[model samples]
Structures are given as C-alpha cells and as structure tokens.
Target: MSLARRHREYIQSLTAASAPAMDGGLAPAAAFDAAAGHAPSPAGTISTAAHTINLRLQHDLRRLKEIRSVANKIAVKQELIGEYDAWVAGLLEAGRTAPRGTLAPTGADEVLPTIMVWAIDTGDWRYALALAGHVLRHDVALPARYQRDAATLIVEEVAEAALRAQAANNAFPLDVLEQVEALVDGVDMHDEVRAKLLKAIGTELARGVDAADAGDARRLASAAIDRLTAAQTLHDRVGVKTQIKGLEKALAALPAPEPTDPNTTAAPPQT
Candidate 1:
C-alpha cells in the first residue's frame, strides 16, 4: 500500500486503542479536597492523589503522542488532511477530561498547552485555532495567575514558531506571524512583558533578514522596531525614550553610509 494509505490505517488503529480505559473511577471528593489543600490530610493520602493524577496525565500524554504521529504523517499528504483533523479532534476531547481549577490533577495545566501546540505544529489549524479560543475562554473564567501564565506561554510559543518559519524562508511564515500577532493582540498583558516580547520578536526578524535582500531586511527590521517601540510607548514611554536616546547615541558613533554614484561606475564602499 502507498505510504499515505498505510499512515491512515495506522491512525485508525491508534484511535481504536486510545479510548480512555473505563477501569478507573474518579477520585473521591475527599481526595480532591486534600489535594487542593482545603482539608488537612496525611502525606500518604496526598501521595495517593499525586499517583492517581500522574496516571491520568500519562494516559492523556500517550494519546497525544499517537495523535501527533498520525498528524505528522498526514501533513505531507493532501488527501489525508481530513484524517488529520479527526485525530486532532479526538486528542482535544481527551485533553478536556483532565481536571481544571484548584482541584485539578497535577500537571494538567502544563500538558494541555503542549497538546495544543502539537496540533499547531502538525498543520491542524482548525484544532489549533480552537485550542487558542478555548484557552482565552478559560483565562476569562479562571484566576489571573493561572490564566495569564497559560495565555502568555501560548503566545510565546506561537510567536517563536513564526520566527523560526521566517528564518527557514518558508512561504507560510507570514500567515503564522499574523496568527501569532492576532493572538497576542487579543489578550490583556502587562506593558513591560508585552514590550519585552515584541522586542524579542523584532530582534529575531531582524536577524532573519540579515541574510536576505537589503531592502527586504530593512523593511522587516523597521517593522519589528516599530512594534517594539509601540509596545514600549504604550506603558513605559519614559523608559523607551531613554533607551532610544541611548541607541541613537550609539548609532551616531558609527560611520556614515557611503553615497552611491551610478554615473561613476565605481563599486560602492564595503562595510
């Protein structure tokens, strides 16, 4: 059989095997209360709760790995895209059963985000997009500390992936960049963190452009700088002003650009 057909069969097999095992019952309410520190419990009970949480986390992770394997294979075959979407949907459903809130089983927070990114990386845009939306909704419902941290991490991962795509000269880098930018813009964040992240993205873009055409590099770099500057100005204008002044002084110390004379036929001066 062709590789695509084989991959589809493999995905089918994986899905059949990944149905959550029906053997285990939900932990007792007392277990959750102990885990969340609402009731004082002995170390032994807490350890038991931890072990249970770990087992559930492991099952979820295994399913994610299998789904990701299928997704990766499907990404290379246009005909198998639907298969990929189905697997992504299955994985997302498994992720949903994990605990949330103070009583959430340990490690659920970290694992959910990872599963989301696996979908994102494997070209399962619909699921990835849904995961992003789900996270935003969760952020609104949950306390700021958990919600903000999760949202920020997702934004960072998406933005970093976009930068990597740009560096590799991928045709789809612009789309990824725009998606990440939209996600970042949709959220509420502290000014300082936002400025730092935007500046980091700009630096990455500038570096990528260094090996590209001069005009293109300049345009990208200028755009990056503008994003950083804008972010900084919004909440920390004084700090940004000082930083720009310092940068200007440093730039002024550099030699001026050599004038190009097209009529003279002489080579422009090298840096």
Candidate 2:
C-alpha cells in the first residue's frame, strides 16, 4: 500500500481503536456508581470532606491499577497498541463517573503519553495517536501547564520520527504531525522548542537540494516552503527566519517540474 494511504488509515484507526469494548463489562462512572448504589459522601467540614476525597481517590486509583495490570499482561502477550487503546477507552469512561469537580490528575496521566510512543517505535502509529489524544484530554483537566508542555515534547519527537521514516522510505509520520498541530492549537511553545522543530524539518527537507534532480528538488522545495511558511506563523525566531529566506530563494531557482510519462513528451504543433 502507498505510504499516504497507510497514514490515512492509521489516523482513522484511532477512532475505531478508541471505541469502547462491546462486552458490556464495566459501565461508565456515573452508571457504575448508580448501579452499584454507591453515593459519594456529602460535602461537610473541611477535614471530613478532605478525608472523603482521599478515600474516593484511593478507590479510583485501585480501579486504574486493575486495568493497568491487565494492559501490561496484554502487552506481554499481544500488541501494546491494542492494550493501550482499550486502556484509554476505559480511562475516559471512568472519568465520566467521577462526581462533578472531583476529577483530578491520576497516575494514568504520566503513563498515557509515555507508553504510546513506545508503541509507535514498535510500529503501531495508530494506537500511539489514539493514546496521545487520550492523554491530551486528561491534560486539559489539569492546572499544570507543564503536562501540556510534555505532551508537545512527545509530539515533536514523533514529528522527528516521521521525518526520519520519510527519509528512509518507510512510513510517514503524518499522524504524529497532525498530533503536533493539534497539541499546539492554542498553546504557545517556548521559542527554543518552536525553533528546534522547524529547524529539524527544514534541514531534513533541504538535505538533498544540492544533488537532487528537478523533480526531487521541486518536491523538497515545496515541503521546505510549507514548513518555513508555518515557522513564520509560529514565531519570529531568528534561526527560523534564516531558514525561511534560504528555502524561498532555493525554491524560486528550482526548475519547472519534469513530465512523468515517457510517451507524452513535449511536442510542437504540426502545421
């Protein structure tokens, strides 16, 4: 299959992989609490309410541990991609069960963004994308800006992986590229981070221009133009601006595209 098509499939698989298990085993928190007939403790004096909160948190952690152990077992036997995907689905559902204002950072927050990347390295990009999405959702609930930052860092690593794969004639990291775009949607990355990512993409795209045929140069020019154009939008970092100028000049000098079909050569009109 074409790399592009596979990438598109990988992205679509995220939604399917995120689908909840059909066995009807555990209901969402709201439904589960209702069915179990467990009422959350009423708000009261600070100390008592705090105690209640801690107890509930402990229960929640225990449930997460149950799934984590099962997921690890699956990872040992099957693919971590499948294990992480199902685990994410369960975590999201469990989030729904917590009483309003009671949802806080769980230990899953640390692992969700981490394990998925391992899956990516092991050749499960789709599952990694799904896992990152789940982790980002959890980060949205936290007051720590750094969790979001960490997610972006993971995405940048994925972006680098994608570029490397492209160079090696392997899978495209478009899923991870999209993830990077999604991660930075409203967030401002540090200047260093922004410049580092842009430089990596630009340098990689520009690597072969000196030796490339017209077609290859044109392809490289197009990607560099797009990447540096986006870098401008990201920030006015000096390094990025330098890259943009150089790439634009090189693009302007690239020859027009070469025709692909041998039988369809350029021809003069007959009189």
Candidate 3:
C-alpha cells in the first residue's frame, strides 16, 4: 500500500477525536486537532502534525530500547523491524512533501536514519539505499546517542554487513556495494571503514573469476588485486593480504594475449 495512505490509516487508528483531554498527559484528540489546524510552513518549521508524530515516535523508541536491552540475538532485533515500518513510511511521506531544503529539526528527526539502520540489519538493501539517499541529500542529523555521522554510519554499517555476508558464503549484491561507494564518495570517513568497503568489493569481484573467460578472468583478477592492495595500504590489518595474493596468482596463471602480426596490412572497407 502507498505510504501516504498507510500513514493516514495509522493516524486514524489512534485515539478518537471525542476522547476527553487529560491533564499533562498524552491527549490524542488535542494532537489531532493541532495537526488539522497547522500546515507546515516553507521556512523549515516543524508542523503540529510532525510534533504529534514525534510523540508516537518517542513511545516506539522507548519500547525499542527495552527490547534491545534484553535481546541478544540479531535475528530477534531483525524481526522487530516490521513493527516500525508504518512509522518509517509516514516519515518518508512527510519528508517527500516538505519543501526543498526544509528538513528542520524535530522530535522525530531520528526516525528515518534509525530505520535506515534497521533496514540494513534486515538485509533490505534497496530500502536501506533509498533511505541513505534521503538522509544524505537532506543532511539529516542522527540522534545524539550515535557516535558517527550519517555518511560514516552508512559506510561502516553496509561494509560490515557485506563482509559478514561474504564470510557466511551468502550472496550480497556487488552493484549495491558499488552504489554505496558512489553515494559516500568524497565524504571523509575512518580509513579502516573505507578499507573494509574495498575489501568487500574486491572479494565480490574475485568471486566471478572461476566462471569468467580467460581474458575476463584476467581482467577481474587485476581489478580485484588493485582494490585489495589499496585496502591493505589503508589498513595493514584489513585482512585482505591473502585475498590479494590469491587474485595475483590467478592473474599470473592467465595466458598472455596473442600479439597482432606487425607486417599485416589493413583491409579496405567492404562496399
């Protein structure tokens, strides 16, 4: 279903408008009234609707924290991602309709970036990359609890996931890794994190060597070696030395290209 439509439905599922207001307590009816009363301004102001959404977001965040504290398994946390899907979709809808460059601070500012992380945890690469584009383009700030900036978080998180997938013999898309590299291009991050990215890319490239033709195998091996070597240079302990050596050996095993005859004359173009 469309996110915008889902958002409207989700909001309707909250407390009814006729509910009596509570003193210094959450008043869903008042929140709804405020949302209906105030339209978002063009000057990056947080609308009443966004404020109301933030209240719900805070409750979800608290629940998430409680779950995370007791949950030790990655699988358990991955399963919890679905619970936040509607809220994430709502944030995306709001952001899409906001004026250009109007991404101001809000109580729910952490929602989208946090969902991006969850997307990666669940192996939802397309969703993660889509959120990455929005976060980077709008310059969204991550919550204070996070130690890294958006670019660093994205690079490190995706790189780590790719490396883990490789270790487990799972199929991680090479184009997804390449797209990530392009997304964070020119953004400075830790050398080791960058090295990990290169390692993932090079390893994925090397995987095709067995099925490629002789010439293609040579080309792939060369490219892999270049990337792995650069990764090694960035971090001596990046764990790519063995991989680099393997690619180098593969490239050495390829037969040299046959040279053209120096004395051959060019044929005239066919009529």
**What Cα-based lDDT does every candidate model obtain?**
0.47, 0.50, 0.72
Q: Stretches of candidate 1 above 4 Å error?
A: 1-55, 58-88, 91-114, 117-130, 137-149, 156-177, 234-271
| TM-score, per-candidate, Cα-based | 0.39, 0.45, 0.73
RMSD of each: 15.4, 12.2, 7.7
The numbered model that scores best in lDDT is 3
Q: Roughly what TM-score does model 1 have, to 2 decimal places?
A: 0.39
Q: For model 3, how does the per-residue alpha-carbon lDDT over 40-123 read when each residue is reduced to its tens digit?
A: 333323446556666766776676666654334346547666756755665555556555444434435677787788787777
Higher-ranked by lDDT: 2 or 3: 3
- Tally clashing residue pairs in candidate 3: 0
lDDT of 1 by residue, 1-271 (tens): 4333332332222223322421132222333333334553342233232344446546644554566465544453333234334323433453344233212222223433444555566655655667775555444232233445655656665655554564585534444445556676757766565654564455455454446565555566556557657757765741345544444443444445567877887677999
**Residue pairs clashing, model 1:** none
Ten-residue segment with the worst summed lDDT in candidate 1?
18-27
